[model samples]
Target chain A: NAGVTQTPKFRVLKTGQSMTLLCAQDMNHEYMYWYRQDPGMGLRLIHYSVGEGTTAKGEVPDGYNVSRLKKQNFLLGLESAAPSQTSVYFCASTALLGATGELFFGEGSRLTVL
Target chain B: AQSVSQHNHHVILSEAASLELGCNYSYGGTVNLFWYVQYPGQHLQLLLKYFSGDPLVKGIKGFEAEFIKSKFSFNLRKPSVQWSDTAEYFCAVNVQDYKLSFGAGTTVTVRA
Candidate 1:
């Protein structure tokens, strides 16, 4: 079964351009998260959703918006991209059990802004 | 806010050499610790995790981590390393809720 999948594996955008990244999971997890991976920064959470129609801000939520319109999909959008936003974006999901659940990650989308 | 720290930024070792990566967290109370590995051009995968009960947890690829509550540390260890073990390792902590805080990551390069 496909675990977590992210779209647009690589993209290049000009400053002020807008784009959306789509994440889909077939495991039917209750929690989904969006994170950006930078060199030496590891993975920083951008946004998260506990369930469908519910979303929350994460450590690095600025300049990004997320929506859990469906149980299996979480969308992350950048209204106006900036050079600083050029980083690899990852999507992860885990079960409802808080402490015991392990997160499954996506292949990651690499974005480069110029 | 809680934070995770990985002691090494990069490590290079010969094959069959023992490998150890230090990880420390700032959370005082009960916490869940995890180690994730990312191979070249691949996503992060679970290396090992510690919730409760046994302080030493064994995971895939012959990797293991020991959780020391007193020291607030979860260090990963492998008896022998192979060239295939070259990858980036990350330490993560989950205090409450499902949110996790991650360390800066340590890149390990195993020479043949």
Candidate 2:
């Protein structure tokens, strides 16, 4: 089964442009998250949804927005891309919350903003 | 805000050498710790995790970690390493909230 899949595996955007990264999970998980991975920053949470129709800000939510219209999908949107946003984005999903659950990660979407 | 810290940014060792990567978290109280590995051009995969139990946890690829509550540390170790062990390792912590904070990551390079 494809646990987590991220769309637009690679993208290049000029400054001020907007784009969205799609994350779809077939695992029927209840929680989903968006994270950005930089050279040394590891992974920083951008936004998350506990379930369908529920979204919350994460550690690094600025400049990014997320929507969980359906339980299977979580979309991360960059309203206006900036050079600082040039990083690899990852999507993750978990069947449960807290320490008991393990997160399944997507392959990642590499975005470059010029 | 809780945070995870990985002491080594980069580590290089010859094959068959013992390997250890230090990880620490700032959160007190109960916590769940995790170690994730990312091979070149691949998605992050679970190396190991500790929720609650004996404090010593073994994971895939002959890797293991020890949880020292007093020290607020969860260090990963492997008795012997191989060239295929080369990858970026991350330490993560899950507190009460659903959020999981990750460390800056440690790049391990095992040479043949």
Candidate 3:
């Protein structure tokens, strides 16, 4: 059902370049999140949206921005890529916030900044 | 800020050996706990979760976890392990139903 889909499965950007990562969910969920996974460090939230037109900062929001103009899509943007920002990004969605519903995650987008 | 901890960073075991991975969270109030597994080159999949009732929860692949409120711990266990059980395991906590915080994952390697 394409529970969660992330675009640009892999990308390489030079320092100071900009790019956007797209996440789409067909689950009709209300909560969507962007997270980065690094070696040894599990998954850290970058940004999140409770619903369409609403977005909020997460634990690790530096160097990134997010938009949720539509309920099914959440976009994470890196205005200026940095070596530290090179990590695997994941998108997740849940039917409800603060509930027991499990998160549906995307395969992940691997970004490398040089 | 709330935080989650997974004590075992890397674990190796022989096939059929029992398994246990320790997880602890720092929060006093009510919380929802989750255990997710990531196989090689795959997305994170929920193994099990605990919401309100039943501290002992059983999940897929013959895995289970028990919630100990006093200890603020939710430890995962399996009676028997297989080579296919090798994967990275994560412990997550949902506080106030708003944000999910994840622990530094534990990598389990099972030798057949």
| TM-score of predicted chain B, candidate 1 | 0.98
TM-score of each: 0.98, 0.98, 0.98
Candidate 1 lDDT for residue B27: 82
Between prediction 2 and prediction 3, which has the larger lDDT? 3
Distance from true position, residue A39, model 2, in Å? 1.0
> Tens digits of per-residue lDDT for model 2 on B18-93?
9999999998789989999999999998899998989999999999999999999999999999999999999999
Report candidate 1's interface RMSD in Å: 1.2
The A-chain TM-scores of all the candidates are: 0.97, 0.97, 0.97
Least accurate 10 contiguous residues by lDDT in model 2 chain A: A94-103
**Candidate 3: regions farther than 4 A off:** none
**Model 2 residue A91 lDDT?**
98
Structure candidate 1, residue pairs in collision? none
lDDT of 3 by residue, B1-112 (tens): 8999999999999999999999999999999999999999999999999998889999999999999999999999999999999999999998866678999999999999
Residues B1-112 of candidate 1: C-alpha lDDT, one tens digit per residue: 8999999999999999999999999988888889999999999998988888999999999999999889989999999999999999999988868698899999999999
Supply the global lDDT for candidate 3.
0.95
